[model samples]
Target: MELKEYMNFVFPGLILKPSLYYQWDTRIHFELAKGLYQFKSEIDELNDEYFNRVYDQTTTLFNEIFSHNDELFLVTNVYKHKGDIKRNKKIKVYNHYINNKNIRFQLKEETLPYMFDDDDADEYYTSQFSLKCQKQDIRYPVLLKAICNQDFPPLRPRFNNRGISNYPDLFFINIKKNIIFYIYDDRGCEVIASDIEAIRPIYEKYNEWIDEYCREDTEQLFK
Candidate 1:
């Protein structure tokens, strides 16, 4: 089958939200700040435990699926502003999983304009009375929440939320086709099969309930 046809057949009506941090700015920045303050420090601790468990499981799963040697790295992106000099954004710190020496090529990039606000001056001033001007664009925390709340097993998910927020959970990477497949936990009900074609049938069979679960749209689904 053609690649397009295969993707459509396998992933019909999939509404992929381009990595969360793309074009991130003031609006997303504030939301992330609110989420962090509301969620608290404990969230970071929980996310650490979550990553450890997921990484261990992913290693085992990869080994079972493929016999050849392969490397896995946790990747995340951080955005920095031109001025207001802080060497690294806060979001980069939360992605501690990649700190290890063993993992290779763990980081990737996507860019967004710094401190650019879409709203007119009057509208922005009215909406955010406190700050003279919005600066910086980081989006890690909110993206982490979205990944964690999803159903996929603790596999390290990618993030585009450049270093504007402190999401302690998400990670990102590019993979080789020959070395094991990519298994994505898309929220709670769906699992996306990437690269490895042989297991698509199995994934589809196991995750069949996701369609019904997604359709129900119950509040409980998120929890």
Candidate 2:
């Protein structure tokens, strides 16, 4: 199963968002899962347990996926609420590259617009992970990097300051086909993350598909 199908299996009744204003290049969306209604009744250790378990499960799944392939990497921007919402740790694991071999993962921190003309500090943000496939020539991720010396309209600049944030570059080369995968959490981190089990077989299948068709250049793309 692909992204859409896996989303349904992990957390059903959620759909992708068409567009969002004042947001980054996030073209993804979703809502809370119907299960785990117990949290609604009462918020206690169970809530914390649920969140931790879900996060651990997700991270483990991704760890497995990345471990299996030398050409894939995981970039996680962990957010912590310590009097203020701050990025606790920015991790780039396994492989972080734009060459033909690897695909970099990304998840942007987004905020909701309130009545006031300011980014709401109180509003909890959602999580959306993306996989951007690009050529080796591109120096930076597409979301922040300029294409042909021109930026995509209304650029959501990352500054890429300190090299802390790493995303996929959008600069494509005609030699091979490049793509992006936006798996979103529309519930604003309300529930759990994605299903690795559902994604494994399909992801393997996708690689097989690419191997069968996009030939020769595949090795150059990875290492």
Candidate 3:
């Protein structure tokens, strides 16, 4: 089915904010299966049983859809949280039988937002602001790198001063078609399919439909 048709059926009756205001950072929360918890505490604190369970289940889910021919990657943001904590939020990416599992755990400094400044505080603040503004645009390259790395952590963190957060958990790239599928967690497993051509029609149609059905304020947010 066409993307719009799918959205109409899936998103209709459901209340979803427009793509702009929709917080990409929340994807990890939505994707975690029921009863499985991803701790917000330090990674070192994560128990091996919980980690293995999550990993095994996640990998199983991914492997079901993606294969070797299809490139899979994780996408997420690196956020410097309060208390000087650096956390990596995981998201899941799968396409055509190739599951790029736990790709967010493997991200490096170069793949995340970076800042150039003498003042450490200023750099962190600036990077955070920039990341919020340009996250959608920067998402592609990070996902590409994740796929290329075979979903493994790079040697050493990419940089020393900056910390990362809200990293993407999953990405699927159809190399032959040059299409990128960003599968995020929202309410359920929400998939955002973006190809210059494939998604434009859906966006246009969604805009048109919103114009007919949504309030002006709501429309403004969604558009």
Candidate 4:
């Protein structure tokens, strides 16, 4: 079957890349956002009428994304520390998960822009807001919440990383690699295609890694 770009891959938080679950498309529809400006709107408290509309729309989307039979969504929320370059900063983090045990990832050119990159920046978090994402894997999201709440577990999931693999003392499960998906996450799912050739070569590496892992795992199971 002929599959489209967005539909066969990606979930909500992976908007910097390609996807097909357009709002105008058939069956399910969702919108994408980029940069802090767009999220500023999603994060802010809204008035009653507007909040109702947003709440209803998000409620419908939540139900659809969660109840689908086979397709799995890997929604990841990237969190970086906000204050001085001190270690063990408690930053609020949210998570998303993929259920395929064989799928892996490798990050591309960019890194989290807001994270403290050098000794010059503050790594401490403020009480302004806490990050949150629902409908994630039970194990993974719990880990993230612990980080946000207690600042423990000091190992970040690393991939083909060029810069600092992680912030000092702060850890998160890398959305790029070291994650797995399982069959239970694949009930009514159609994994139309695993890799997209048009993607940036870096991200393509991640997808290829996932495809190869899945292939090898399936082979091993049957062998």
Position 189, candidate 1: lDDT: 18
Winner on TM-score (2 vs 4): 4
Query: What are the lDDT figures for the candidates, one per model?
Result: 0.30, 0.28, 0.32, 0.26
Q: Name the regions of candidate 3 deviating beyond 4 angstroms.
A: 1-33, 36-49, 72-172, 175-190, 194-223
Could you tell me which 10 consecutive residues in candidate 4 have the lowest summed lDDT?
Answer: 182-191
Model 3 weakest lDDT span, ten residues long: 125-134
Would you give me the overall lDDT of model 2? 0.28
Backbone clashes (count) for model 3: 24
- Per-residue lDDT of 65-155 in model 4, one digit per residue for the tens? 2433322333332333453243232222222233332332321112334333457445422221212222343244333323222212332
Per-prediction TM-score? 0.34, 0.25, 0.29, 0.26
Q: Tens digit of lDDT per residue, candidate 1, span 33-90?
A: 1112222265523344444434443443334433333232232333343342442333
Q: Rank the candidates by TM-score, best first.
A: 1, 3, 4, 2
Lowest-scoring 10 consecutive residues by lDDT in candidate 1?
A: 126-135
